[model samples]
Target: MSLSTEHLLGIKYLNKQDIDLIFKTADHFKAVINRPIKKVPSLRDITIANLFFENSTRTKLSFELAEKRLSADVINFSASQSSVKKGETLIDTVNNILAMKVDIVVMRHPNVGAGVFLSKHVDAKIINAGDGTHEHPTQALLDSYSIREKLGSVKGKKIVIVGDVLHSRVALSNIFALQLQGAKVKVCGPTTLIPKHITSLGVEVETNLKKALEWCDVANVLRVQNERMAINYFPSTREYTQLFGINQEILDNLGKKIVIMHPGPINRGVEITSDVADSDQSIILNQVENGVAVRMAVIYLLAQQIKR
Candidate 1:
């Protein structure tokens, strides 16, 4: 089955069937994107408005590229340069944009539930790029898609997400996605960086990086979200690195090959090292590549549901 919802709001709202449909659709787009002529005519008549309230590199570029590849007319709106700087409310701003006949709205806002809030008020279909610390559904979709591409299957695979879970939308979304696909999920990092009651999602928390690495089939490392931290959560970056950093030494210590994954904008020596990120086992780049196709699948599916 395809996505039943009008908005790609969060992974928590999705079931295993939704995820499977996205991956299956992505499989076709993945093949199409790899071809010499990558553009598709499926969304040629559709228009997408990318509204980003937060600064981003990978997600923004990936979405724009995916929309372009799907042959959709795209408009990008950054809050920093928009009328939002003049105290314009989000609904007013988006409604103004939608007045131009945009069919779909993909947004990244710093406020949690911003997408959900927009969906309730807007006529255009909403896609949450990343909404505060709530969730990044498409990122999790591409992440799981990349994992399945690499490790062959997600069912029963052990995956540990390491880093700032307290402020990570990626972590929450990933837990929902991975667990839905029947993967065993774990979180490892400094205790302060992990939120209380995350275990209610059915993942264990391991404070020790070594033990966590030893236990998982894939190590999905996360970067310290310094911008999201209100105050000092840990003593220092150096101390945190000393305790949880993944380097060649750690990789060598692992007796078997374990796939390493990072979302993006990686800290060189903090949660993961340069050597480890560039290692063969690291599917970081593949995740970035798969992001385009996965997003295309999402946009295509959602575009089909649009009345326009």
Candidate 2:
């Protein structure tokens, strides 16, 4: 399965065929990662620009590791250290990077459509590592790959994404992915964190944790962006835990055969309890492992879209 000649600006661009291709590619790489000497020369001589405007951990490291494994030149640009802090515009910075003949730009910005903007201006291909609460294409791909590997198939899975949906690009991207792969999806969070009336996205939205738990095959917990909170979204962390945290009680209540997941740097006893995150039912670590394979597939596939 080959990649099409289109920019991976969002998961919304992926149809069933594209999904299958990336998944297949990821499956190929999973074997590659398991080998003793993990290096792929597929992308030899390619230079990738890691343009991140937002603070990150998992996403950043995953991409760097992916590129290095593929034998690609990796240059990381942080907004705080760059001319963007010295009042340089996004376009000017992108043009400066492009002038160096980059092959692609893996970007994560604080605003929605930041990746789209770079895709429009840069000659290189654009891979959306993340763009605010808008989309995180690689993340969505890794998630889909994780589900496919673990469940054998994502079809007919009742996947529930819980916590901070309104400010979560992961939630938005994952919603598109799960629905595309034929999983039933519902988003659950407190009214303040979940926002109002987003059920129109072909998924149910709920505010009650117990009710959502009763109705899911996989329970996905999201991290709280305490740094990005705008207002008093929730009363307190204690109150949030009482209402939404995934403790041992919630895990037992969900019964067996329920898979748990969190996009990492998990707030441990916060959005999810230690038991659930460390449980046999938890696929959280799989998500991180697959993140590298998925990112490699994304960079390899997206780079092929460019005609040199």
Candidate 3:
């Protein structure tokens, strides 16, 4: 069995079966990575290109590592160093890269629908590493995979995504992915940072941090995207931290242990206090490890389509 869709452009494009299939594939890869010899010849004959129009550390490295683990030849592209700086078109850059006989293209771009647009114009299989504030499909998949690993299953779990939802591709992807797996989802942040019509996505909005934490089995804290914000969403960083930050004290008061997760480059005391982030309850490290295995599964499965 394989993914229902051709391109992993967004979680919104995937159905429950596709998600399950990816998880099942990831289960195999997870075991492989744990073994003495982590490398696999699964995509030995395939070539992949990693194109980033925006700066990235975690996502870019995860995809590169995944591709290498599967023994796929890899090419890394940065927009800043390329003709894109000279105002070259997206299609021209991709077409030039495709000339190298690449089988798959993993890309992160600053514009929403960049992946979708590329898919239409390019022959190589497309994977959206991230596309502006639209979606990060692999991140959401690994997130749900982590939840399932920690809690046995994603179904019936209450997940509250905390902070900066308006500027987050992760939030949107996670919302769709979690809901698809039958988990209850919520968005928590300042009203300015939270999209006004997010309720239309069937997620409840909770502005109060303690209340949101009290209601959730897992709190996936997001980074405050100061880079994306053109204006102040809140008065000050100190104020935001005081009101919304997750701390050890807040967890202790809850009476029940709730899993803490952060998609990294954490803002430390801003979205989450250091004590809470480094505490035993934080699966932040696990999330990072699972990212590689889950990404390997995605690349492997997508490569299978190329073989077929």
Candidate 4:
């Protein structure tokens, strides 16, 4: 259940057994952590810096907690409030930090392949917290953990990931992880939002919200990317709701067996209805909780590979 030191570049880097191993390892780690002594000597004296180019509440804090739980010193950097805003290039800023002899870099950049770029240029081990609609490997890992924990493994589960398919790194990552875990993955959204040939990744594509609703064991809704939406890719919020929103009508169409999930900072009535988000079947909260544990597992496991 252990990964190599090659770096978790993306979900494409991991297979089914590898993911299951992490989940199993996390489960065991949790049990061990419940004891009177919660600390682990595995990563003592390690240094992990969190470099975020974009704002995030869940992912940022999760990574920090993960490092602290392993007894590592944590340094945080933000693009807006840092020297990067003062005419420093990403590379130059990162080099300055790495000069301090940090053991690992956990980065979230708005640039695709930013993590991969840093890994190529740095001595310290790197984990991609996220990088611009390209991939969020840990989000996918935690989502997989959340799904498996809630539904008792993903094998044969008919899971439908709805909304902003093209813009969601979480969707892209989860599609790979979920498919690898033997689930029938489907992505549903309007034409502009859901790209063509996405099924080549081995997931089904659907545009009809109603049909996608009935076919799902889990409806994992996504947030609309207001930050990235330009040229008016969507007609309007009202129209988008009419076509793609996971509202009461969609919820009514979905059977009681279906579990609803949303990555947080939801757009409320647009992507998911508030009622469904707060319902018994909703694992949105669980995703947030599992996110911390999954990240902890990633940090705990990867810290051993840091060569510090």
Instruction: Name the candidate that leads on lDDT.
Output: 3
What lDDT does candidate 3 reach at residue 298? 91
Give Cα distance to truth, residue 223, candidate 3, Å: 0.8
What would the TM-scores of all predictions be? 0.99, 0.96, 0.99, 0.95
Ranking by lDDT: 3, 1, 2, 4
Which runs of model 3 end up more than 4 angstroms from their true locations? none
Candidate 4 contains a number of clashing pairs equal to 0
| Model 4 per-residue lDDT tens digits across residues 105-136 | 88998889988998888777788988898899
Deviation of model 1 at 159, angstroms: 0.5
CA lDDT, candidate 2, residue 46:
90
Model 3 lDDT at residue 164: 94
CA lDDT for candidate 4 = 0.83
Q: Which residue pairs overlap in candidate 1's backbone? A: none
- 107, model 2: CA deviation in Å? 0.3
Query: On TM-score, who's better, 3 or 4?
Result: 3
